[model samples]
Target: MTNTAQPPQQPEIPDVLSEKKLRYVDIGINLGDPIFRGVYHEKQAHDDDFHDVVQRAVEAGCEKMMVTGSDLKESEHAVQIAVENPGLCYATVGVHPCSAKQFDTHAGGPAALLSALEDLAIRAKASGHAVAFGEIGLDYDRLFLTPKEPQLKYFEAQLDLAVKVQLPLFLHSRAASEDFERLLGARLPELPKRGLVHSFTGTIEEMQRLVALGLDIGVNGCSMKSEDNLAVVKEIPLERLQIETDGPWCEIRPSHASAKFLAGAPPMPKAVKKEKWAKGLMVKGRNEPATIPLVAHVIAKVKGVPVEEVAEAAYNNSIRMFGLGSMENASS
Candidate 1:
């Protein structure tokens, strides 16, 4: 009989809190998502508290955040956010796989659309508003939003653009690792600063493959949903691991496997329903960069390390990958 491999058991480790305040860099955030502006599903529900949200994350020790761009408009907005915030925020410019069909439906035509994306990336990089080029890759699980063909075609096209833009990538992959790796692998030699695969929830094998290919793995609440997820987090090399809130989504829930490790984490802001939102209060179910420490805490617990170690490593890894320079240099 053949035996299947099992996930290695993680030894129990005591959760410890360090007196030193650890800094973090949230490598992926949908800061331009309308939800941040009190708009949901195309309707304004409350006052825009964007600055307040940024304030909370700052108080929580999240010194830098990468505003994610999942499409052309979002990419433009991301750059603007970075420019306005300066060192506190940076942007990633690229279309997500779920939005790949926009290439076909764009009024400017596919060639013009790709050209525009390249233009944004190049311009933003010049001004230091953009750090990575992505949120682009394959997402087979959400084929309902976009067909497999366009996803494949546009993913390849974006890879070419990444080569031209010469920025580190901010990639995504969901249930499409085969084609994802194949396409990325072909372009590896040209992309010296191979980027991260954010919100990763893949298995040990997949994680190892990406790491072997010189890419980083980003972890968030979605990346720690189950026992299997914890195992994957444990195996991630400290140097190659980065953390993100992936917020306004991927909030850590009470039911998540990572929640058990949050016993000693810093207290999150008081949460209120969006309708009852007030200054300094977190919207009840919405995630924010303020929760980045909780992610580091979970990884530390699962890997039998100190929270500060995880926090420091993730912060440095993110800064290096995004080419944001030293935190001090960034502020100056």
Candidate 2:
């Protein structure tokens, strides 16, 4: 009988580094969203546009990114993208609170929906590219999309699933702090230690509670919307903070008008540069992973830390939380 033994596989090559260049990790980006389609020079191929976005992000010093998965279909696509890109990208697998209706009994029932999500999570984990389980949590602001009861039900289920899978979380919360806090607080001991409250727009008191719970806070354009939000941002400890784009959605508020904020803004990548972008289909201020530096810049100014310091801290936090092994080798 012939032996069919195969040799051990070598790890993928890490991003080439320049000693002077700072590396950043966007802990969240919805790259699979259709909003990005045709935004890059009216490109017809989504794969090409996606690659362009990744390349530009790398060039802009965003060395790594976590593609968010709001539902099972998006989660599958996210994992595939992460697998295809290897070192540059990772994925989160979960259902968003707004889409809680999909898991409702009236729709397809929680058992079927959750079973599908669990399978996707297992497959994603096996791929060596999935980092967390989320875009999951409560979103009372969009209760019209899904009522409160089902949203709570699904959030609890996903939390339990995260514990089962032993992965970190990429969480969301908006205008639903009471129930969000209560549900999450009940499961605090059961959930993974390294979870993020992505795109946090909560009050300082709420932020403090989450921090006390040992969860990291994700700051994006929405988090910097007003003086009230800026005040909340200022109160967040540097050690507990991470930055994200939440792209094709949250761009830095134009109303900020601070020279420091404007100065820190990253320029548009040449890959996506075009005189005219697709109307209506594309957002007026389309955020992308390449703009992570800009988010970092805003964070630095708000935190009163150097931009490089903010970048390094966020990068370090992301790698530590997500267990991104490739970056450990690259950083060393």
Candidate 3:
């Protein structure tokens, strides 16, 4: 809840990249145990399933992938992937609220969530490449398992950890954006000016509020389907935006271009046709880092900038926000 660091004046990063020079840095991808194809569905498949799919993602455009793990075990797996993959992969450690439903304990359930986060925090600090605190926030929509309190507890704990470690955060908030805002209203995490609220599906008011609090928004393919968000992109200065595919999970279907994919995933072409908030494909459950460029294309169209410029800005913004600039190997 202390004052977050103020962001510096925006740098003049080039706005576009040539077709062959396109390099994507996906801020979100889940290539672990539960590969969770696309945006929402958890992978219930076998252990060997994601290797080929992830290889495809790597071959596509994902230069540096930040994988999000929903719980303790999954987080461990995500970290392992980053370790094995070296400079090509990165992971964030935190308990995603929706998946922590059974995490209650006696003597203040909040303590239990905090305790779990402590472990992730330690692991994250040790894993030099695990750069952020993520997929952490409230979800009023998924009320069946986790109630508001536990969700809030996990979110606050992760936020505090992020502040303590000087890492940025990748946040997730559904219908609870307001609640998320209330929790972070005056209490912005004391992070270097790089924290972001991922896949922002909230209203303009909520977007404005988060921006006011010194946080940026993660632009996934789903944001392209919403009129509100499109307007948000048109209005909210691009300086507050960053690209995220939320891959191996929320990829928008109908590949933006004919970049034939070699990865295996559930074919849910209808998902993108819905044209509502989800667009079925992107938010359905089968996303990967290879889908980053496609998402970036849509973001460029919405902002009326060349795809090259949008990609470059998003990449540079991500570097500046997550402290990747200091890492000698953190470059395209």
Q: Pick the candidate with the highest lDDT.
A: 1
Error of 1 at 230 (Å): 0.7
Cα RMSD for candidate 3?
10.4
lDDT of 1 at 96: 98
C-alpha lDDT (0 to 100) for residue 307 of candidate 3: 76
Off by over 4 Å in 1: 1-20, 325-332
TM-score: the better of candidates 1 and 3: 1
Error of 2 at 86 (Å): 0.4
- Residue by residue across 304-328, what tens digits does model 1's lDDT show? 9999899999988887778665654
The digit string of per-residue lDDT tens for model 2 on 206-318 reads 99999998899999888888888888888888888899889877877667532246573555533233334322112346677766777788777877888888888888888
Q: lDDT of each model, Cα atoms only?
A: 0.87, 0.76, 0.63
Task: Estimate the overall C-alpha local distance difference test score of candidate 1.
Answer: 0.87
Q: Report the lDDT of model 1 for residue 46.
A: 85
- Please give me the total number of clashing residue pairs in predicted model 3: 29
Better of 1 and 2 by lDDT: 1
Per-residue error for 175 in candidate 1, Å, reads 0.3
Candidate 3's residue-wise lDDT over 200-290, tens digit each?
A: 7777888888888888888776665556656766655577878887765555645422122213321212323212422112223456565
